[model samples]
Target chain A: GAGVSQSPSNKVTEKGKDVELRCDPISGHTALYWYRQSLGQGLEFLIYFQGNSAPDKSGLPSDRFSAERTGGSVSTLTIQRTQQEDSAVYLCASSNAGGSTQQYFGPGTRLTVT
Target chain B: EDKVVQSPLSLVVHEGDTVTLNCSYEVTNFRSLLWYKQEKKAPTFLFMLTSSGIEKKSGRLSSILDKKELFSILNITATQTGDSAIYLCAVLFSNTGKLIFGQGTTLQVKP
Candidate 1:
């Protein structure tokens, strides 16, 4: 079984630039989540999608951050206007339909806002 | 405001020594507690505790949760150098299914 996968392993962008990070969940995982880990800090929840339900955006820091899951398998997290504080490793994780299951994580995408 | 906290933000120990990491949380509708080990970009799931007093064990690692006190403890017996990594604790909310994580504990094991 293929694990979760993320794209653009590392990205260096100038401040104010918009960046989109992609995540491909496991073949049948119905619950997907996005998290951000700043340097020397814990992972901060970003967003979550479960099946066809409305996505949970409470964890998103601001309007500049948004995410969408298409076809229930892939998700994209967009940071509209990047700031130096936005520089962090963005991690994607997925689990079975039941949220109680342990999530499988992917090799995160490191975004560096210059 | 729901939050999770880990004690001894950083620890140093020699191989073969036993160590215990602590996690205390204040969250509403707590469903389960999880433990993860991160040596790199990806974090590997270690344990998920849902019941109080029941210990989950794997190899040299074990964890116990206390719902009464709203805390959990992860213990490693006869630690190895490979155990040097960041240990993260997270609490899952039953209502939203989102995990609130603690600022992980960094462990350094010397050979």
Candidate 2:
């Protein structure tokens, strides 16, 4: 892909139901990240992956929120037993490397937990 | 806790008016500061400042970081209606890809 891509541009789910958002990062990129943007708010760091393992899961928000990347290409963010507060836009980004490099972002998945 | 704060949560301006957006941060480790412009969906990258006093310019948009003051400012000259968007500021960790973002400034450029 020319840039990062995310799935299900818009998603609406009932409270307590689980949801999965997907991201396909640019090829050969070694770093992938997930962020949550609430209404009128900035991007909130959720998780980061280097290769297939996530070194920094410090921002996962809660145990119910988990993300994994396989083949260093595609990643999935799963929200278990979603709450109304989980409604937000989930953004995914990929960089050639981590840190100092600029990250390319996806269109983002708008998750609405009713 | 790392924190990034942006001022003037919202702004209204006319075309051709120059605007300056402010960002200040409190972080344990500061590698670089980045600016992003978001219109509808995703945020597009603008500028990344690592050295203090050096300005990164792209057309009418320029940004400079001040490590001493722990702040950065983005200036848009002769703004256009297309410039109406949410301007975001983020601080990057030196060794990781994690970015701590500010609340963002919503700029409305009136025609």
* Candidate 2 chain B minimal-lDDT segment of 10 residues: B89-98
**Interface CA RMSD of each prediction in angstroms:** 1.0, 0.7
How well does candidate 2 match the true structure, expressed as C-alpha RMSD? Answer: 0.9
DockQ of 2: 0.93
Model 2 chain A worst lDDT run, 10 consecutive residues:
A46-55
Give each model a TM-score: 0.99, 0.98
Cα distance off (Å), candidate 2, residue A6:
0.5
Q: Write the per-residue lDDT of candidate 1 for residues A45-75, one digit (tens) a residue.
A: 9888988999888999999999999899899
TM-score of chain A of 2: 0.96
Chain B TM (all candidates):
0.98, 0.98
Note the DockQ of each predicted structure: 0.76, 0.93
Local lDDT at B29 for model 1: 91
Residue pairs of candidate 1 with colliding backbone atoms: none
In CAPRI terms, model 1 is classed as medium
